[model samples]
Target: MEPIGHQTGRLAAFDSLRSNVAGTLYEAGDPGYAELATPWNVAVRTSPAAVLEAATADDVVQAVRFAAANGLAVAVQATGHGIASDLDGALLVHTRQLAGCTVDPGGWARTGAGVTWKTVLAACADHGLAGLCGSSPGVSVAGYTSGGGIGPVARTFGAASDRVRSFDVVTGDGRLRHVTAKSEPDLFWGLRGGKSSLGIITTTEFSLLPLPYIYAGALFFGTDSVADVTAAWSQWCPTLPPEATTSLGLMQLPPMPGVPEPLAGKFTVAVRYVYTGNADDGARWLAPMRAAGAPLIDAVQTMPYSMIGLVHSDPEDAMPASEASCLLTDFSADAAETLVGAVGPETGSPQLLVEVRQFGGALSAEPEIASALCHRDAAFGLYSVGVAAPPELPAVADHAAGVQSAMNAWQFGASLPNFSAGGGAAGFAASYTPDVLARLSGLAAHYDPDSLFRLGQVPAR
Candidate 1:
């Protein structure tokens, strides 16, 4: 997609950007421009006319103002883990150089747009604190929170955006503003779940969980019990209390060194659990899942909070990926059967991992104020992920979508922001209800009257 036919003359502003920022300015001829513009998903081919590596928040302000003055659009990217569309011809603000992190032992931390979850997790661990990290800690914190971060502990703690204290953003009008619940209320509410359609977030502050250690990990089961174990887990999860968070995954892992001996080169079922309460209670809560089937690996145990990656152990390497997410009100008996029958062990599923996380607990409760995030009352979150570059990967993504559509009768109102991909305006709009979208639209109009930040995931005016 080109720049909507309005990128006529931005030479003067682009010249100013090249002269002001300490970071490198990459144009069409730059060697690294192509690689840097591409996203982790790889499906969308981002082709920014010029890429500005923002060394500080001021650079972001300059970039936005330059885009506005020159009639060019603006887009933001950190790790590219969540890009939904090609940033074609937009002035891409690369936040990688704005890396800054400060952890306070008082159970909170402030970070720059370029900071990733892994860095925050390590910093918080030093003070016996924990940041609400997703399955893969490599994703950027600002990007994750901008999408209402639904992670492993989502059921217990709710969305990561709920803990946000403030956001330092560069509005499309070329202004740097500090936004919070009390200041710029609409922007504050919209930014929490609106992604990047409204403005460019340069820094954010969020509260941390007081979890220094947790009884969390996954228990892998062989294919023979995949159906039985999955059905059992499905029934068992609804009865879990607020302290216990759980999800089940159907995986077709290829034989690889990092993969355990029993799991690789075959299909398997993994019952992942995270108990934020006492260790003894966590163990008691996991007993049913442990007894569900003969396990290949039982890695669930009390471990340091920083070791939370053991629960899912999502791939760390960059690769082409395709993903989809939906909310389910409840997985009834019929729904459970439908899910298992469609993707059961004997079905020869091609997905790398098909996961269903039991939601409720804190997730069902609303934040103190209204926000753009929708479908909080859904009973579960169904997500599908598969490699997209390999020859067989297309089939895998299709099968995963099939499994998801099989449960469409129970599909909730919208998709979760974290799991949405390349949705563009329609996709981002799906994450919110009509009212929330309206409010976000109003804020976008007020702050970005020129409509510069309309790439993906931001509600349209």
Candidate 2:
């Protein structure tokens, strides 16, 4: 909500911003300020001087121009899945009112900044089309695609950024422009993964996949069989074809309303999978994982693409959370042992979830048009998340560090942008190589010479 007793900006400044835009503006203590300023992660706080609930792209341009003239920084939030702690003393652009999605039977779709994956999926289902979507269907398409989104069918369809057709964006210099591979080559490359570094995107269009339906879901087992299941997964992933995408998660679930009866208030391991190919081949390939250990719930089977969100079943409600992640060099036998010893059932771990996903299929290959997104050759991704209250944040942060340190031998020296949300410059350095970062900095200076696009993990030259 509103910061304790600290007021917002000066009345004159608020008046100036209000006069510049047609959308509604709320200062810190205003009626709608609290609702507009609150973010999804309660553990992370945002105290903006003012919030602009932009009604259209024209409002976005006006807000940018106002921030530039006032010498104030700017930050953007849609669904708030990726908001960081950099919103202080800045003007926030709220894009929730920019929602729309239209799918053409010609194999392409266009959406506004506020559209979510769930909306796109529903629209595409009527045409027997599938769009690349992340685990959580509620996150905005702009936020996910800006961070180089990885989805349930990532191995088969590749990253969401690779399929983007064009972007309508407003750079920090207060200019709205269209970005495409052939038109604005540098901005097109930088925006796909650089995210909030060069501009604020207003709309994005991308290609869609043909044919619906997929064989996907998760097999749940008690934590007692974690070691056995992990070992089997390590051996089985190498044998899988590009049509299959899979991950293994060690879960410590709290007894909540939506959690299943078998997994509530218990420790468990889930082997989640998705296959885009025919059902017969998918079942044949997934048989060994099902036989690895007797599952409490054998929920893996063929399902329509419209029901894809059932595969991961990510949390939809907002909660206080702290997360840490790294790319893995390998998932060897010793690596499995390291994972168990660090955050396993007997380790007295504090994290709610620890997961590792297999990579390297179409994900490793370059798209015909390349962007700044990197780490394509990374073998696997290791991520851990802890529930955090305001007072217990230090312990959660330290425990995540310890988990990352425990598997230092297997680290790939890079991280994924979507997962490394709050990590600032250090995480930015880890995600991109020296060359890409250098190019991003060069482009940032050329496009945003005033350095107004200063949010998120932008590389500093």
* Runs with alpha carbons beyond 4 Å of true place in candidate 2: 1-9
lDDT of each: 0.83, 0.86
Instruction: Give TM-scores for every candidate, taking all chains together and pairing residue i with residue i.
Output: 0.94, 0.97
Q: Least lDDT summed over 10 consecutive residues: which range in candidate 2?
A: 1-10
lDDT of 2 at 44: 81
Candidate 1 backbone collisions, by pair: 84-422
State the displacement of the C-alpha of residue 159, model 1, in Å, after optimal TM-score superposition. Answer: 1.7
lDDT computed for candidate 2: 0.86
User: Which segments of model 1 are wrong by more than 4 Å?
Assistant: 1-13, 390-397, 457-460
